[model samples]
Target: MLAQTALAGATSFRPLRFSDDGTFQISIFKDLHFGKSKDLVSYNNDRNSITVLNTILNAESPDLVVLNGDLITGENGFLENATVYIDQIIGPLVDRGLTWASMYGNHDHQYNLSAEALLEREQSYANARTQRMVSGHDAGVSNYYLPVYGSDGSSDPKLLLWFFDSRGGNYFRELDKSGNIVPQPNWYNKTIPLLAFVHIPTNASLAAQTVVGIDANSKPGINNNVPLAQQGQGWCEDGTNSNDCAYGGQDIPFIKALVKTPGVLGVFSGHDHGNTWCYKWDSELQLPGVGGGNGLNLCFGQHSGYGGYGSWIRGSRQLLLSEEALGRGELDTWIRLESGDVVGSVSLNGTYGEDLYPATPNDMTHS
Candidate 1:
């Protein structure tokens, strides 16, 4: 049914370009559970997760690659084997012409396809811009926004990348019995220092992991514990209890539009397949009765496929940025692994303490 005005008077998209050393790398490949059970050992573990996503895009030569959702593993009875595991998870980012985008995991339309058939197989990929649901409340469908230009390639954009579609399942409904689900309000417009990629991790990421806590590759307190996602289910809240996939925790106006949007600084997710961390949501920890803004940064991603279930170890999540680190508004992230080993080296908007490396200043250009 896909046509909610198919982006009516569409605007915004066709920006994300930056790399003649002005920098703008990103890479977050999340859960890739590929065809849940299409056998042949799940297509040889999604072809060894596309050879660990082509050795991290030929060693981090990224200017974008965020198939940040489950990238397949639907319950398939053969919707063309979910388009052959979504063309083997975007055939190594379309054989390296690279510039990519995607989001939507709740087992990505669980079985036989239908998040408008994975948004019509990612709009036949010409490096997918990933946006849909022209209006609102079809619950979710990869909300848009992706501008990053600058290195004299400007038409206005220093950096900004927001993509939401945290939908997969659970249709909240419980106005009574104290199983809450009443709060709802939203807003968004103009923001920078941003970086959001969703596929479930709201509930203000469990109130920013209860004011900055869980990190050594996550999952400590809060009952939405990651990995295999069944013991209470990963983050987000409100609990009407439909076997707790922890749905969007009543969303609270998209977590108050990510704490009043403008300069968000962080917010990344992936259906908790053994959580990799990056906390700090401190705007003085609100949400006690829900309402407040200016707290940003909350991360998770590093489950880079292998057909999910997590023994930990598969990786992804990178970032980078530049143009004098976005003119010192900060950016530079990490997580690599798949045996290349880089690990949680944070610094987006500066300091959440992981391993701090910081030093890649040579490329500079912004005008």
Candidate 2:
């Protein structure tokens, strides 16, 4: 039933991307489950995630910022309550200067520490020159391949990021047992290409299907056991069991292993909470954000959809890429909202069609 495309059925709102010779402008904020803010929906903490990150860094001052994931809904599910809300809300946006990167959802590793106490809780919540620019496999890791340069992005052919993990099988039962839902073949063979990141969303990253057979080998066993499902319950896609891992998992082998491979460009995720957004596997380009509202969004205000805390506001968008888009098309994510001052753009490529949100004060109803 996944039909309704234009940013995949636009509701919560988010689709920002600019880089077609436009120099820079990166602002991606997903699943700000900032320590479950007080559940039962509209969840937000870390002071409402730093007051919605200082009102979107002073209303879009961004050069770059990607907090894309349930940055801690770890609650009683544990991992030190999602590393104390990532050491107080995503480590101070990389200590103030911004230009950041982080990915992991399904309540950021829910809890359960082994694998050396989850690698010593990922080295006491990494962030020291972003853990020495992703140490290349260890030396106090932060997962690697950052490069945000235009002077500041450190190094390594700049702008090629990949911070994947996507583990969290519902804390072994509502969050803990040393957390980990999936995606760990040594972090999937140390992913490559120009991009990568996951917090969950690899049921072949949804093109939606599986009425029966071939939907990435349908399975709801997510490598075994369970969390919270029910869309046909055997991981949908026609389940009769046989080792179900949730129909089309591992996002179709992690997008067939990095879109086109060489210098990969994009791939990001953040559980499916609500106030959603998409563009799962971009062969090159088409990098989008925000998808946290499946819990049950009672309108923008979220009664509980995706557990709440969903906000979206934009002013511009339109990427139109293609330096031969890695694997030939599928990466034109879109989103823009400003409402009254007049601004609108929300085309999530279900074959494009949004002039930009609902209009008049950027209204898209819902709430």
Best by lDDT: 1
Segments of candidate 2 deviating more than 4 angstroms:
1-21, 28-33, 36-46, 50-52, 59-65, 77-103, 109-165, 168-186, 198-261, 264-367
List per-prediction Cα lDDT, in the order shown: 0.62, 0.37
Total clashing pairs in model 2: 52
Name the top TM-score candidate. 1
Q: Please give, for residues 244-305, the per-residue lDDT of candidate 1 as tens digits.
A: 44443455656666677677777787787656666656655676545654546677777777
State the weakest 10-residue window (summed lDDT) of model 2. 294-303
lDDT of 2: 0.37
TM-score of 2: 0.27
TM-scores of the candidates are: 0.31, 0.27
